[model samples]
Target: MYALNDIVEMKKQHPCGANEWKIIRMGADIKIECQNCGHVVMLSRREFEKKMKKVLKKADSDK
Candidate 1:
């Protein structure tokens, strides 16, 4: 499962041509920032799940 600070690959690429996003916030809505352009987007959990391809990097839990 994806968590805060995790890098995830979306099913589609952002306008900046970045396919990777960093999870910033989570709850009923999930917030993601584009790695290339620093663009932030908020999506519903359901929508996020549908659009997310996979978790590229899991967040370090040992912090």
Candidate 2:
């Protein structure tokens, strides 16, 4: 599972050769930004779940 601001690893490496992605937006569609190239991609929740390998860093909650 993933949440906003969480760093995650995708099952496939991005074209930029990065596997790390940061969750920037969430809803029915999830938006992720590549940590290496600043490229953003939005995928449906289902697709995101299927592509997401693991959450590397969970977002810290303020409260």
Candidate 3:
């Protein structure tokens, strides 16, 4: 399961040639920023789930 600030890879690489994205927002919709180009986008949770390949890293948080 992914949450805010997690870094993830998508099924397809971005046109900018980046496959990694950082989660910047989470809710009914999810927002991510491209790791390579600083591009940002928001997608529905369903879309995010459909496109997400795997989470590369989870956000660090104090428990």
TM-score of each: 0.93, 0.92, 0.91
Return the lDDT, model 3, position 58. Answer: 84
At residue 31, candidate 3 shows an lDDT of 96
| Model 2 Cα shift for residue 20 (angstroms) | 0.4
lDDT of 1: 0.94
CA-lDDT, candidates in order: 0.94, 0.93, 0.93
lDDT tens digits by residue: candidate 3, 1-60: 988889999999999998999999999999999999999999999999999999998887
State the lDDT at 51 in candidate 3: 96
Among these predicted structures, which one has the highest TM-score? 1
Clashing pairs in 3: none
> In order, how many clashes per candidate?
0, 0, 0
For candidate 3, give the lDDT: 0.93
Best by lDDT: 1
Q: Candidate 2: what lDDT?
A: 0.93
